[model samples]
Target chain A: AQTVTQSQPEMSVQEAETVTLSCTYDTSESDYYLFWYKQPPSRQMILVIRQEAYKQQNATENRFSVNFQKAAKSFSLKISDSQLGDAAMYFCAYGRGGSEKLVFGKGTKLTVNP
Target chain B: GAGVSQSPSNKVTEKGKDVELRCDPISGHTALYWYRQRLGQGLEFLIYFQGNSAPDKSGLPSDRFSAERTGESVSTLTIQRTQQEDSAVYLCASSPTGYRNQPQHFGDGTRLSIL
Candidate 1:
């Protein structure tokens, strides 16, 4: 069985600043994928970033980046130049190479304070 | 149409009644998924449909819950004898392929409320 854990239930960062959300997962599969998703109040879940287990370099999408430590099974999201629009529920997810589904964490509520 | 589309953005039904939720995956997508998100909780995988393969119902919570997809195009999740606990946001997602690297595009979700 695989599980994703987001230790921070809630996180806040000043606008234009940076914040890091922690995530850890337990999986036996050597080949997998990790993702960060943001769900705004509109209810649309948007993919923030993704990291492939085989890759040694972390993934970055504009202001969003991930510190993927495969050995420790830790995938954290770092939001640089955070904006008010970044306020939402962030979820960490894992998907094994051949699996059809993604295992998601409980989620972290992020607030961008001005 | 554009992106994954889910009908009836909000549904309010009475307990014991049966309800059907619909999902329209993005064009050319080969995989579709169904998930449930309880209030203040993360999304829980319910079922998966990939191309012509048999649907995966392993994540389904109970016998009352079932889903069907027509060759990866559209999917409908039907919950029979709905209980209060069934009141939650039902979300649908689709991806270009079922591969691990493909990111799933999600719908706004149907907020189901059982009265």
Candidate 2:
């Protein structure tokens, strides 16, 4: 079974600063997908970014990006110019290709200090 | 535009009572999923439905938990004789297809509280 691990239980960053949330996974499959999801106080899970294991280039979305090191099985999310709205619980998820189930990490609570 | 819809944003029920949670997927989405999020924890996959294929019940924790979907439409998750342990936020999501590249859009989960 594939498993995702987020070592940081909580993280804090000042506004306009940068922060990285670390994530690692264990998977035997060569092709898989990794994702970072943010959950606000409203209880809605929002997709922050994603990376495909087969792709060598890291994925970037606006201020959010991921450093995907496939060989190390490490996928970390970096948030630049963070804002107060970015404060939330972030979760890392992994799913193998052709599989419908996604395994999630415990989660990292991010706090943006203004 | 509207996203996935889930009814009764909050549900408080007694132990041993049966409760049904509803989820209306985005129109035309071929895949729908159910997950449970305990407080301060990550989401846990519960069940999945894709197109007309047989639903996947592998993630279901026990026989007490069951779910149903109607031809790429609404899905209902039922918890029979619920236990306090069953209390958690039940979330529903949908994607254009069950493809790996497509990310799942989620609904504000229904917080189920067992009293």
Candidate 3:
């Protein structure tokens, strides 16, 4: 069984600043994938970024990037130039190479202050 | 039609009653998933459907929960003898394929309340 943990229950970032949300997971599988999802008040879950365990290089999507440390079982998401729209509940998820299920973390509520 | 669609955006039912939540995945998507998200908690996997493979029901919390997907189209999650604890947001998602790297697009979710 794989478990994802987000130690921070809530976080706040000033507008135009950068913020990093931490995530860690426990999985025995050598090959897997990590993902960060955002859910706004609308309750719509949106994919933020993803990292492949096999790829040593971290994944970056514009202002959104991930610091993936496979050896440490850590995958953290960094949001640069945070905006009000970035204020949402973020969840970290893990999925094995051959599995269809994704294990999710409890989530961290992020508030972007103006 | 464009993204995953779930019907009855909100549902309220009494205890011991049965309820069904529907999910319509994106066209041409080969994978569908069901998840439950309780208040202030993370999403919990409920069931998964990929192509013609046998659905994975391992994440279902109890026997009271059952889901069925017809081919690669619509899916329904049924809860029998619903309990108060069953009140949560039922979410549905679908991916182009079942591959681990593929991103799953999600629906707005149905807010189920068992009174």
Candidate 4:
């Protein structure tokens, strides 16, 4: 079984500042994918960014990026120029190759102070 | 629907009652999944269905939870003899294929409250 861990339960950042959320996972498979999902107060889950294990280069989508270290089993999310809208519950998810289900972390609540 | 769609945004039921939650995957998706999110908790996998075959059922917390999918389209999650612990948000997701590396698009989720 694969497990994703997000040690931070809650995090806060000043608007326009940068914040990083840490995530680590346990997986034996070499081919897998990691993702960051944001769930706002509206309870809508949205995809923030994703990283493929086979890729050495980290994935960046707009202000969201992931620092993926496959050997260390670590995948962290970095948000630059954080905006008030960035406040939400961010989750780290793992998906092994050829599997449709995703294993998610406990989630970290991000609060942006304007 | 353009994205995975779930029905009855919210549901409240008494204990021992049976509740059904529906999920309609994206048009071209071949894989669908059901997960449960307890208050202030992470997502707990329940079942995974690809086409008509369910490849995994290990994540279901108990036998009270069961889910089924028709072809590659809609799916229904049924909780029999529901308990208070069953209260949570049931989420549905779908991907273009059942491949694990593919990104799964999620629905708004159906909040189920057992009273």
Model 2 ranges off by over 4 Å:
none
Flag regions of model 4 displaced more than 4 Å.
none
Q: Which candidate number would show the highest DockQ if scored against the true structure? A: 3
Q: How does each model score on TM-score? A: 0.98, 0.98, 0.98, 0.96
- Regarding DockQ, does 1 or 4 come out ahead? 1
Model 1: CA > 4 A from native: none
* Reference interface contacts recovered per candidate: 0.80, 0.71, 0.84, 0.86
Query: Which whole-number lDDT from 0 to 100 does residue B34 have in model 2?
Result: 97
**3 against 4, candidate with superior lDDT:** 3
Candidate 4, residues B1-115, lDDT tens digits: the string is 4888899899999999999999999998988888999999999889988776645888888888888888888899999999999999999988887764577788999999999
In candidate 2, list every pair of residues with a backbone clash. none
Write one digit per residue (lDDT tens) for candidate 3, span A73-94.
Answer: 9999999999999999999999
CAPRI level of candidate 2: medium
User: What lDDT score belongs to each candidate, Candidate 1 first?
Assistant: 0.94, 0.94, 0.95, 0.91
- lDDT digits (tens) for residues A63-110 of candidate 1: 999999988999999999999999999999999998979999999999
Encode model 2's per-residue lDDT on A1-114: one tens digit a residue. Answer: 888999999999999999999999999999899999999999889999988888899999999999998889999999999999999999999988998778899999999999
Q: Put down candidate 1 lDDT per residue, B1-115, tens digits, no spaces.
A: 6888998999999999999999999999999999999998889999988889888899999999999988858899999999999999999999998886599999999999999
